[model samples]
Target: MFWALFLLPAWAVAGSACLRLCLAAVRAAATAPEAAGDDRALTLYEAAFLSGGPRRVADLTLVSMARQRRLLLAHTGWATVVDPRGRDEMERSVIGAIGPGGQSRIAPVRAAAAGTEAVRGLADRLVGAGLAVQDGAGSIAAGVRRVRLAALAVCALAALALALPVPSDLPDRLVALWFALPLALTLGSLLIARMEVHPYSRWASPAGQRLLTALTRRPGAPADDPAQLTAVALLGVHAVGEPDLRAAFAHRERYLEEPAAPGH
Candidate 1:
């Protein structure tokens, strides 16, 4: 009878977590358009967003600008506006995020640039074209968080079960062994999610992922293009090949200079 007290909640928590996690996973993958839209090929920026979202787009732009000497990225992790001109909306965003002082730490600049309307605008285009994940990113994140919370809840129930009186004739290990069923469920669910849910992630839908793979494999697609689209799109800044470029991004310091004085 006492076993009923804890086992009931344990099973409930475990079942709930798995259910929520599993609910839309298949739907999420299957719902996206499987074929390309309008025969449109993914642009470098679009590829970046599809592979790694807005941040990857920002990284791609930063790397592009740095290569052109329009923006100077130092090994010490600072971004200095060199051209004060943008060739596109994304370039303008990076410049604007740096502010009029023309200098700021790379981290904040990256965050601000990534959050800019220019980036979201790109997302809008991708989603409209059926290349980006249609599922709200917040939902995906919340689902993952709920699964984690459920794991903890299951553990709590197990503890409660152990604390309560054990049914006669059943050994303590036997009770734990029985409770292991739910514990195994939570762990197995987590492992399965890590593998199955990662490929599509939050940025690219199944169709978008297919496009990314196509871009990388297309004929005459150089391994190290001027944009480094494949590397940055797939791996973000970590794939940055330039030592100083990577160092500039890795800068974790919080630094934002004041706006330039009114007069020289």
Candidate 2:
């Protein structure tokens, strides 16, 4: 009984979080509008921004620079500039982020590029064009995070309920019922969220996703071009059929394990 008393607050908090997430999911779905005709023809960078947010744009820019031979990304995660000139604002921003040395760690370059006017411009353009869901995207992401936390809280509550002693007056079944309520609520909320949010990508709304799908289906598409390569980075390797370009976009981790000595 004392354990149940201790778990009551957790149960309440989890239940509330679950309810809020469900409401948020429903509201996002209900308020989302259909895309306009012109909005369907999204540029590679624009699609990247819509599908993966500002970070995707930065990734595309880096990949584009590498493809153009203006930058080199070593497996060690260092980025070096081959050409100091930047033809466009996005390219210029990336080169500028590398600083006067013309070389820096990829992670810091990404961080700096993420704050550039070019990235901000891309986001603003997407939102203004109605291809991105503005405040709703952040809200949905937050709600999903809360739902995940609620799942953890439910597990904690269950463990607490089981570990604590029960009163003589209360049956084991009653104790189980109490714990089951919050668990069910949490699970149900997750289910609703999955169904409602599954159609939309991380940043792109349903309409943008639909357009992305159509654009990726065309045959004999060129993946070597900077624009096409940018699309490949956004849509992932599956969308790029060319082996060479696919290899170019293949992500390498920053750290690598050194080989052991021959004697060892």
Error of 1 at 177 (Å): 5.1
Model-by-model lDDT, in order? 0.75, 0.67
Question: Please, what are the lDDT tens digits per residue for candidate 1 over residues 1-264?
Answer: 576677788888888877876764754555535443735677788888877778888888888899888988887777889999898899999999999989877778888999999999999888776676665543344456667787788778767777876554566677777788888888888788777766535777656777777787787544446655567776777888889888787763454563353121
Candidate 1 stretches with Cα past 4 Å from truth are: 1-9, 30-39, 135-160, 163-170, 184-200, 222-225, 253-264
RMSD of each: 4.5, 5.3
Residue 234 accuracy (lDDT) in model 2: 57
Question: Can you write out model 2's per-residue Cα lDDT over 213-256, one digit (the tens) per residue?
Answer: 66667564444453457455456434655454444345333424
Winner by TM-score: 2
* Overall local distance difference test of candidate 1: 0.75
Candidate 2 Cα misplacement greater than 4 A, ranges:
30-39, 135-142, 166-168, 220-227, 235-264
